[model samples]
Target: MDAVPGRKAPMASGSAPDLMYCQPCAEDGNKILPDAFCPVCKEFLCSTCARVHRNQKITKSHALQDKTSMPSSFCAESEDEKFSVTCQHHSKEFIKYYCPRHDALLCGDCVIENENHRSCMVEKILQVAKRYQEGEEYISLKTGLGQMVRDIENYILYIQVRMKSVDEENLTNINEFRKFRNEINQYLDKRENELLAEIDQTKRTSKTFLNELKTKYTNIKSATEKLQSDLHAHEANSNQLLIVGKRAIKELEDLQTALEKVSMSKDVSRYTFDRDPATERLLASETAIGRLKEGESTTTLGQQQQKQEKKQQEQRKQQESKQQQHKPTQAPSHKVNFQSSVDLSQSQFSRQPDIPMKTSGDTRNCFLSSVACLSGNRILLADYNNQSVKLILRPTWCCPRLLCQVDHGTCVNCPVTGQPSL
Candidate 1:
């Protein structure tokens, strides 16, 4: 019963009542079985309550039902039904009016007391509330409440799973970061050993070249000293010693020329060992190995959810359309004479099809192979030459439209925009 006023939403679908007890007993939070039925009050009363009710001054004249005559059980009414026959504000008066805009049940005293109730459109509660629970709106309300509860639960689970995934991803990233750092350390250590070996090689090559030059110069100096001592041992007037001295001097000049040539050809000049600026800059920055990129997983998950929701919406639309197509329509209240409504004797011509049926695929003139009549005076025509179907409007309506074209040999399949394929 839609007697609830100032309610947030409709009640959910409930199970059938199985517990049988006195109405008065249940109302007073008790569970005693009913012994008698009060027809005037529409209440199931227990033995003690029936005795008290029968002795009451107001209900003494009313007839009570026999214990055997009462129904096997009484279904418990809602709290709204308890206050349905009377108003809470006006306890002494019966409910007389209902405000449609506010969805409020009111008594005559309430209508007279409130200024807004006097101006607004009011209806008799008996007229509006008749078969209220059986109406479509009420049924949909009950269904919507159940669906909303399920959606909320599913959404809560989705949130919890997403939060857990994010935590796991964070741990995975931390481990990845540590692994990457270890690899970098190993690479730098390898490069450092190579650089040290290269420096040692350069030192050994330069020192060896210098030592060979020193030994060649020392042998030349020793040979020139021995020749000078032998020449001094001869007399000052000896011609042989003078001639030998001259020859030795020429040889010494040739040796000096050879030393200059060797120094110019294979001497160690200079070298530079500068650090790589890119590597230095990278080490100085906060994110040396790699920067953390975030939100990709969350964004992908949201996109997937959106796609799922879109797919579900499409399925619902398809289902609803199928239901509408299969739904049984009510027959006309009055008889419809089909022969009188449509006169087949009359001949009608439409020039609309002449223009569209002459496509490139039509090798011959258009031929109406078959024709079918649809509701609302619409006609469906099949063209044999063009292999196409057209929806021709009635004389009352405007024009004919090409609905679909099948692929006959090389012909393209053209269907109307926003129309489903057959």
Candidate 2:
């Protein structure tokens, strides 16, 4: 029999059948002509078979189309048609109900056998599947999936931008480093050339000194040889021998004096190259030459502090000398003993009672800018209005005698040394 166009015929050589045989009836060795096709089961069905299929609870929901209107592709048997939808646990039963608790579609036998679904509600799988189609849960799932996709896309973009920034930063750093390195190299090259020139100058100077000595020696040797030859010739002529001998002896004495003056002396000609002490130390230790040393900064700070202290001391002495000129009788010198009794371990300081001091013979309003307590009841006070520092001696409680007044500038207190500076 000739095969229908776009449809597969059975694997049998025979005369043409009046109608297409039902696949399910063929399996039972029955050649029943099919009137309809079950799309879900992918089977051709006779009227009687279709009625039986519709009567079954499991297959009732399956869609059936008239065989005459069915597509040629549906009539053809494909690889998908070879598979049957049957329960893995119960091969004879079709999956019908959905167990919500187990989240699985199960046959009636499987639903009964699964102990977890014994007390749980089981709904028709077709009804549950219908609920999933465009339902609230389905819409929410789609929205969530879309949000996740958008979030992932944004994250990817963020990562890309971050990576690009990192790359650019890394490139910038690399360029900056290269530029710095180039500058350093250029500086080093210039310094190297300068040093080389200095070394060359030293070499030329030494060579010149040596060459001068060589020329002097050469002249001396030539003079001595001529003198020796003249002496030998003069010996043969006794008459002129005495005169030539005297001149030769005089020349020899002069040569000896010149040689004594030319004797090697460091004070006359010394050629030694001295490296900077810092550079020498770096080389000796095999350390990087350009790196800053901790001691250098510390020493610089120490020197500045010393200078500051020295300046303060000089100011203090000038003030003291000026105060001494006004006093008729010399004030007895007193040493101030600054001793603290506070325990360091306790981290506590002892507070002393505040004593107010007043001076006598000051009727005018005086704005005191600075005050310092000296030894033996003496206090130095700087009056800003008067622009003068007064050395007042408090002999008795409030009765003060003005010892001296000196022209003053801004006054500073030397707390560490307990000195008054102006």
Candidate 3:
């Protein structure tokens, strides 16, 4: 039954085919199912598109099939299979060739009619792939890939180890700061002792002179009181009193004079403690005792590892060079005949007419430089004197035959593409 309007989206009914979204609608970012398969276009079409495909002159002849029939001859293609590359200019055609000069992938129509490729010598994709399989760039890519994987793995391991190492390094910094604080404490203790001693010396010096004066005055007062007691004792005897009074008066006069002189002496110099301004400034400032210098936050072990690795590399290079210098070449390899499993029983060696190797600009005898072989008994040769490479074709003794010599064009290695010049 057809889906009714205002109902839920269509579902597979009675196994006619499990519902699938329309390919064209999906391309346009819609999700409607109720589709049928078109083998000619190789796309699933919704009912609306199916009706259009049947009536439209361009696609009217295309037959539609059930949406599902997988595990049989016909089936819906996966995304990869449907990943066909079509030209932007020719939307319906697939790309078949690559134009190196234009540096673009093109279809047959693009090669023939596109003015961009008119002067360009286009290459077939298969021919472009000739050296791609075993080329140096491909080998280097594989090597670089493995190296990147190793570097990433080492970095991951480094991170795992660094997590713990970082904490240990932080602890080291903490301990170092505490040690610096201890050093500051020791220094302060030294300064405190010196200051305390300075105060002690000042107080001691001030007290010394005052203590001597007080002792002298105390002795004088004791002597004066004793003399008064003596004078009263002498009064009981008249003659004794008369004789002693004269001497006693004289002693009293002398003691009075000494006391007067004692009060007349100059004041003693006072000693005091004056703290250094630097001490007060030190107390006022937060960082006076300790300055915090921020070190570069880099992993020490990582740097050490880099250095060790560099050293090992240098050592390895030295060892390699030394070994290469001392190593003996294998002379047997030069003596060994070229070995091959190819059977040449049916092959014959025949003499052919010699072709001239001289060029118009040649000033010396034509000397052979190098040779390369191609398929179908063709050989390539380089003539150093003529400064040209020659392609020689011999009779195949089979269906096709060739002329004497064919000089195609000059060839140099394509550094960018790594493609061999034919």
| Whole-model lDDT values for every prediction | 0.66, 0.65, 0.65
Q: Report residue 111 deviation for candidate 3 (angstroms).
A: 7.9
For candidate 1, what is the TM-score? 0.45
**TM match of model 3 to true structure:** 0.39
- Please, what is the TM-score per model? 0.45, 0.41, 0.39
Error of 1 at 140 (Å): 4.8
**lDDT at 396, model 1:** 35
Top-TM-score structure, candidate number: 1
- Determine the backbone clash count of candidate 2: 0
**Cα error of candidate 1 at position 216, Å:** 2.5
Q: Quote the positional error of residue 54 for candidate 3 in Å.
A: 47
Candidate 1 colliding pairs, count = 0
> What is the Å distance of residue 374 in model 1 from its true position?
45
Tens-place lDDT digits, model 2, residues 1-422? 12332233644667554346776677567887678887766667879988998998767887888867764344454423432578889988777788878888788898888888889889865447745764687899999999999978877776687679769967977787778778978987998999889878878888888888878878878988999999999897887998999999999999878776766533325567676897667568854434323442323334667988999999999888767644564233343223311112423333434334334655555777776666677878877765667876644422111122222322222233323322
In model 2, which range of ten residues has the least summed lDDT? 398-407
